[model samples]
Target: MARRKFTREQMIAAARDIALHRGAGRVTLEAVAEVIGSTKGAVLHTFPNKLTLLEELLRSMCQEWDRRFDEIQSKTTGDALSAYIETWEQSDPQAPSYLEAVAVARAEDPKLLEPVRQAYQRYGNLMQLDGPIATDALVAWMACEGLVLLDLLGLHRFDQTTKDAFFSRLKAIAAAHNGEGT
Candidate 1:
């Protein structure tokens, strides 16, 4: 049988998976290769080393997140703010812990910091909520990030009452912005 032909994107995703679950420093060329049943040579065909691999993964993740927000914005144009809130709450399990590696990259390599900032910028522009609603939107995103991090790090869990309270606050803020009563 011939070796499987994995794209650069595939390798990057595998690297992200390894980094998110195992830890940031664990994203070696050999580890990603094993995840995809490839070889270090194959991974290096796309990335020169672990740093290059991590950089590619971070860039792709950021760009993909931006694209997702764009899609949500277009899909629910009439209620983009609501759509954004829902998407924010429903982010993937891998995302929160994924930030762990990205944060490490901030200090270890210069390339990592920009993607996080860019991703947030894209999300904000797509949200298109103004004034107070924008502030609430930021709060919602921050809360979701906190929830995910807490869960991933085994630190804390947001009880149902707390989660409900957050949703209530966010929805109330959005409702008020839309000229409705929450």
Candidate 2:
């Protein structure tokens, strides 16, 4: 029998599937190894420990968000706020899984959240929001965060009609504040 070679990306992807489907708490080295049909050593070689694995997963998620945000910013000729709203509209469905892993990692060690924190801080700076529009931008931003939270926790879902109304209001705010300050 030949030993299967698992690439780092393949291992990470398997870990993500395990975290999302089996639950974040269930994302163990053994679980990942089992999913990838590899030895524990193989998985450990890619990720020294479970914490490292989760941290990489969270970091990748944040990096992906930044990449998408940049893409949105580049394609949009509107204000930063409007670009941000459009970016939010293109939210990744897999975000909740990464968020769940963040929760688990944070519960174990608060320092694990540094990457996520830094990402958000950088995101705020990139938004170029200030002056009169800051308030509206902040409100719209928080609303999007609330929506992500609701989706992640599977607490409550907004029907299409309600979501349409909410997004209409958000778009209005974003459009109104598009080029107010800068």
Candidate 3:
């Protein structure tokens, strides 16, 4: 009988699907192997441990965010704050699993979140380029982060109208800080 072959990307994709559908806590080497129709050894070949797998998943998520940020920043004429706000606004708020990667990484090992922290730091540097308005941009970015955290934790009490209004205000603040008016 021929052994099933699974690529590293296939294992990561399986892990991501499990994390997104079942929950990050449910993502394990065995789960990923099963999802990919391969043995645990195959997954282990690429991801030595579950923590490594989760870290890779988290890193990949951050990379995707960076890609989106670049695309949006270009469209916004290099307005980092506006790009950040638009990226958050455009993401699916209902899909809390996107943030679940952070929770999983923290649970496994706080240091595993280095990729996430690095991504944020990169964005923070860009926000600082606004010079005098950097403070306002930082404030807007902080607000967006807080809102996302609240939503991810299911602690937000905002109705659809309130959520829309909040995001509208966030966009207004970003625009104002970027010198595009409210």
| Candidate 2 C-alpha lDDT tens digits along 80-163 | 666666666766667533356566566557888887777667767765668776888889877877876687668888877887
Q: How displaced is residue 160 in candidate 1, in Å?
A: 5.2
**What lDDT tens digits, residue by residue, belong to model 3 across residues 1-182?**
98978887788788878876676688899999889888889889999999889888887777777777788888876878788888887777533333566876776678887777777778788876466676777788888888888977678756779878888888888788877884
Model 1 scores worst on lDDT over the 10 consecutive residues at 95-104
State residue 170's C-alpha deviation in candidate 2, in Å.
1.3
lDDT of 2: 0.73
Rank ordering of all candidates by TM-score, starting from the highest: 2, 3, 1
Off by more than 4 A, model 2 = 95-101, 180-182
lDDT of 3 at 34: 89
- Lowest summed-lDDT stretch of 10 residues in model 3? 92-101
- Candidate 2: the clashing residue pairs are none
lDDT of 1 by residue, 1-182 (tens): 89889999788778778767787667789998999999889888888887777777777766665566557656763455565565555666566333554554764576677768776676566556566556766666566667767876668867778877876677666566555663
Which should have the higher TM-score, number 1 or number 2?
2
Q: Give the TM-score of candidate 2.
A: 0.86
TM-score of 1: 0.75
